[model samples]
Target: MPSDSDPRTDTTVVAAPTPVSAERILEAAHRLGLRYFVDDEGDVGIPWRCVVVHVIFQDTRAVQLRGTWHRIADTEHLAALRSLVEDWNATRIGPKAFLTVGDGGIVRLHGEITYPLDAGMTDAQIDDFVFTGCRLIVALVREAEEVFPDSLRGSLEP
Candidate 1:
């Protein structure tokens, strides 16, 4: 009914629906056959099946995906974890790898991916992003396993 053209007519105007939303994003990711849940903060995360993949709202215009690979047992474990981070960052684009060492020789490995809103992310794009995150997670887990024989976090299975 000529929604935006010459408002002189008495026809009803229909508002265009928002193409994407946080709920939609999570739904799209779940469609990839992965289980996801929303946190109290309204952000989304996939921690049901494997390592925690924290999907947080960076701003009104962007969303960030992050997950820690593993927490190290002691300072001696730092070397291999850091090497894995270094190698991953060198070879990958987004989802950069990281290692953190805390008091008492505690150490950990992490990963992240940030996507800014453009025209708006499509459902397929959402699925692809989740899949990519999963792939990165698998690689990091494999590295963690290699670092310490007992560093098995979780299996990347259905």
Candidate 2:
């Protein structure tokens, strides 16, 4: 899924398949101050692993300041920052290989969410900067007998 040592994607924690619940996960995310970012079709970006829904929060985390949500973050949180960059890079340049969890089991690289980036943006600034840019990529693993189910079971794995 990766060619060359693109620093943005290197050494990133592989998105793993974790069994979890969606509603509770989303509630926790909101507690962290993440808002719902809906796509044109109105589907929110939620992460699930192998037929289980995990984190149900905005793919982008925005910070509220001065009567507006501004993209910002501390410089120390680079690991999480890199993941966002890699995800964005995969979307704009070409296909991305993500560790996907589905009913068929956990697999890497099938489909990816694409987007763009700005120069010299740090994780702190990225929160609000990325808020409006991401495409909603909800994860749903195929059930052995069902395609996709409404409302998954278990807690989200962050």
Candidate 3:
């Protein structure tokens, strides 16, 4: 017979899931020792050098980590940039990567990863998501630098 104190007889206590919020995301970033700032619109953002990752809370019960690369590419490199974005989207389990062409045909790179939080998450999960999201987007930017050596304008350094 198994006693109450037996290892197999111990009751398991489950903690409630933590609801996702911008505050929770910021708290996780803080615990990771990352520097963050609130935008003029009150959104929380983490800057990785020239890349800024925004922690966005959605009304649909989701949290998104969106990052924008600071470098702008000339339209002359559009084909190569498109190929890179396509290959990344096709081969990677993202942080989906893409390019945005602005006025005067200038191109910019961006990446984003979203997590559904309808059922909520644990503190560990939130921290992991924040860290992973930031790292993945930064990786995308680095890969772009490798693909186009001197084409991207602006410094990636702080």
Which portions of model 2 miss their true places by more than 4 Å?
1-32, 35-118, 122-125, 133-135, 139-147, 150-158
Error of 1 at 126 (Å): 1.4
Pairs clashing within candidate 1? 72-107
RMSD of 1: 7.7
lDDT of 2: 0.31
**lDDT of model 2 at position 118:** 21
Candidate 1 segments whose C-alpha is farther than 4 A from its true place: 1-20, 48-50, 151-158
| 40-136: candidate 2 lDDT, tens digit per residue | 7533443233321112223433121111001122333334434644654555542232333444332222323232222223333333223322222
Look at candidate 1 and tell me the lDDT of residue 72: 45
Ranking by lDDT: 3, 1, 2
When summed lDDT is taken over every stretch of 10 residues in candidate 3, the lowest stretch is 149-158
> Model 2 residue 11 lDDT?
52
Better of 2 and 3 by TM-score: 3
Can you list the residue pairs that collide in candidate 3?
A: none
